[model samples]
Target: MPEPEKSVRRQEEVLRSVNPVLRGWAAYFRYGASKRTFSYLGWYGWWRLLLWIRYRHPHLAWKQLRRRYYGADRITEGGVVLYNPAKMRVQRYTFRGAQISTPYNIDEVDPDGARFRRTNHDDVAFVGQVSEYLA
Candidate 1:
């Protein structure tokens, strides 16, 4: 909740600070059964912003504040757009049945494991010496 005493701050500043957090939260919950949750959160955020506006301008009537801040059912103030989570589409993950294959389920013949074995003893000894020095 924003402090009414801090009403000195501009509406754009508040929106800019809050938009990123709302965007990230909405994105994280978008790929699941979260439509209801998103809608609830959107309503909650809208109500809170309305309360903040009321606190900031106690002299103004509700109609004036609504006209100034809200348009076409969207909240827009000082050219800053409020991120509404309800607008996010929920996409359920579909099972890709039998489309994925694991190493154990592969039917191909295994190739030779030591196809690139080191043939030079000198090179092998140099690597061993380097490893020992590092250890």
Candidate 2:
């Protein structure tokens, strides 16, 4: 592959790693030489996986699929930030420019991952608010 082509492929790999399911399914749809056209399969696969990614995707950069909450400073250009309250630490780590998988907050004051996953589910808490911007 040319240098640019290699770069694009590497970028795709990074993206797919962040969002394993959508990218995995999209890779399945593509065939032969057409698989190189990652863009085409990407669009369709995201639709299938957006809800999963938004509400419940795990592992920002870690590919083990371990259960946890993940996010990016920006959906477009930031690295993944893994949040795990059980561990009693909110780590702002970097996972490159993969798709953003922000975690939802359950408590108004104590926003934590496992707590958010359990005792609360306010869709509005996660969207269309100043908090989302701050997050």
lDDT tens digits, residue span 1-135, model 2: 665553333323445465655445444544433433454444444333334454444435333322332232123323532211122222234553213223432333344323223323466655556476887
List the pairs of residues colliding in candidate 2: none
For model 1, where is the 10-residue window of minimal lDDT? 109-118
Residue 70 alpha-carbon offset, candidate 1, angstroms: 4.7
Whole-model lDDT per candidate: 0.75, 0.38
Highest lDDT, which number? 1
lDDT of 1 at 106: 40
* Highest TM-score scorer: 1
Candidate 2 has its poorest 10 consecutive residues by lDDT at 81-90
Provide the global lDDT of candidate 1 against the true structure.
0.75
Off by over 4 Å in 1: 1-7, 70-73, 103-135
